[model samples]
Target: MIRRANPADEATIRDCAEQAYRRYVPIIGRKPAPMVVDFAAQIKAGHVHVAVDGDTFQGFIVFFPKGDHMLLENVAVLPSAAGRGIGRSLIGFCEEQARRGGFTAVRLYTNEKMVENLTLYPRLGYAEVARRTEHGFSRVYFEKIIGGPGA
Candidate 1:
């Protein structure tokens, strides 16, 4: 089950992020990046959501409202839950939220080294809008226009 995340889930979200991102870091060759946002800060910003399986918190996604678009911040699923569709569910949640807010599109960025998402996003209807080198990494930016509530 996926639900809105609150400050109380900060530690769990952070732990999940540490494990998932540690695995990702090796492939990208980057130092560890924090998985969870500053709990208090994001809760105030209201952009964090959590994915739970019974009592286990499996993953989380964060996106920020930017004018008419939603900016995907981060989405992390524990390595143990990687193939169970948790990541997809979290993304669906984001889309639902965007549609409800009447957002025109959802935008996000991923490094070229992350082959899984490079393939997954396009397959899921995301289109590459731009590519560039930033912070020593080759980043691909994507956007999916959400065509209203029924779309």
Candidate 2:
């Protein structure tokens, strides 16, 4: 089941974050730089959403409202659950909510080493608008116009 995450799912989200990003931390050369927000903080800030399969949390996506766009903070699916379209479904949900809320677009950033998402987002209609250095990693920024061409 995919739905808005409540504060009660903090622990599950934290575990998911740790397991998903542990390998990438070394590549990015930072302990906590790549992931500044932990599960507890994300829940408290009300930015975390999750995907559950029979009470087991399989994936999550976090985001925050910014100006006329929604900033996707992070999106992850467990290794065991990765090829099942969970990540794609999560992004679709985000886009639906963004458009429903009257947001013009949805934006997100990913590191260069995360090549899969670099390809995935673009293939899903997210256009790479810029790249920059942040917290010691090269970040690729992308945006997808939601309502239409002028959106």
Candidate 3:
């Protein structure tokens, strides 16, 4: 099940992000941005969602609304829980949220070094929109048009 995250979920969220992103440190030469996010603030802003199996959290996704679309700021799945479709479910939740909000699309960015995501997003119907460096990190941006054009 997927649900909005609460303040009490902060630690689990942080732990999940750390475990999920730790492997990328060697690949990217630094911890990924999602590893350092403020979960409390994100929960307070109502932007965090967790995919849970009973009481255990399997993954999470955080997003911010941006007028015509929503920004998918983070998506992390516990390494132990990988290959279980949790990450894809969280993304589907984001699409549901966007459609309910009357947004046209969902936008997201991944570090250039996360090769898995570069391939996965496209298969999920997200088109690469741009690539740039910001805050010293090379980023690739993507957008998935939801519902229909100009939705």
Candidate 4:
């Protein structure tokens, strides 16, 4: 099940992100953005959601409203839980949240070196909107219009 993350879940969320993103550190030559987030602050601000199986955390997604749209800031799955559709489900949850909140679209960006996401986002109906270098990383931005024409 997926639900809003509580302050108590912060450690598990960080652990999951670390395990999920550790592999990319070497490939990208540095820690990915998600690895350095302040989970406690995010949870207190009501922006973090976690995917759980019983008492075990499988993954998490973080997002927040941005004007008329939503920004999907992070999606991470525990290494052991990869390939179980957790990432897709978390994204679906974000879209649902955006639609329910009357947002027009969901936007997200991934590092250019993260080839898996470059392919997966398009397959999930997100269109690449732009590419740019930001915060010392090459980032690719994507958006998906929800609850609208061509959504």
Model 3, runs deviating above 4 Å: 148-151
Candidate 4: tens digits of C-alpha lDDT, residues 1-151 = 9999998899999999899888899999999999998899999999999999999889999999998899999999998998999999999999988988888899999999999999999999999999999989999999998874334
Ten contiguous residues minimizing lDDT sum, candidate 4: 142-151
Supply the global lDDT for candidate 1.
0.83
Best by lDDT: 4
Clashing pairs in 4: none
TM-score on alpha carbons, each prediction: 0.88, 0.89, 0.95, 0.96
Error of 4 at 42 (Å): 0.6
How large is the C-alpha RMSD of every model relative to the true structure? 1.9, 2.4, 1.7, 1.8
What is the alpha-carbon lDDT of model 2 when measured against the actual structure? Answer: 0.81
Candidate 2 — which residues are off by over 4 angstroms?
A: 31-34, 148-151
Q: Residues 28-89, candidate 1: write the lDDT tens digits.
A: 77743344347668755777889988988889898988877989878989888889999999
Which of candidates 2 and 4 reaches a greater TM-score? 4
Error of 4 at 90 (Å): 0.7
lDDT (CA) per prediction:
0.83, 0.81, 0.92, 0.93
> Model 3 lDDT vs. the true structure?
0.92
Q: Model 2: per-residue lDDT, tens digit, 1-151?
A: 7877877887677677777888887776764342567667766787777988988889999887899898887898888788899988888878877877788799999987888778989899999999998867788999998893324
Please give the TM-score that candidate 3 achieves against the real structure.
0.95
Kindly list the per-residue Cα lDDT of model 3 for residues 12-91, writing each as its tens digit: 99999999999999999988999987789999999999999999889899997997899999999999999998999999
Selected candidate, larger TM-score, 2 vs 3: 3
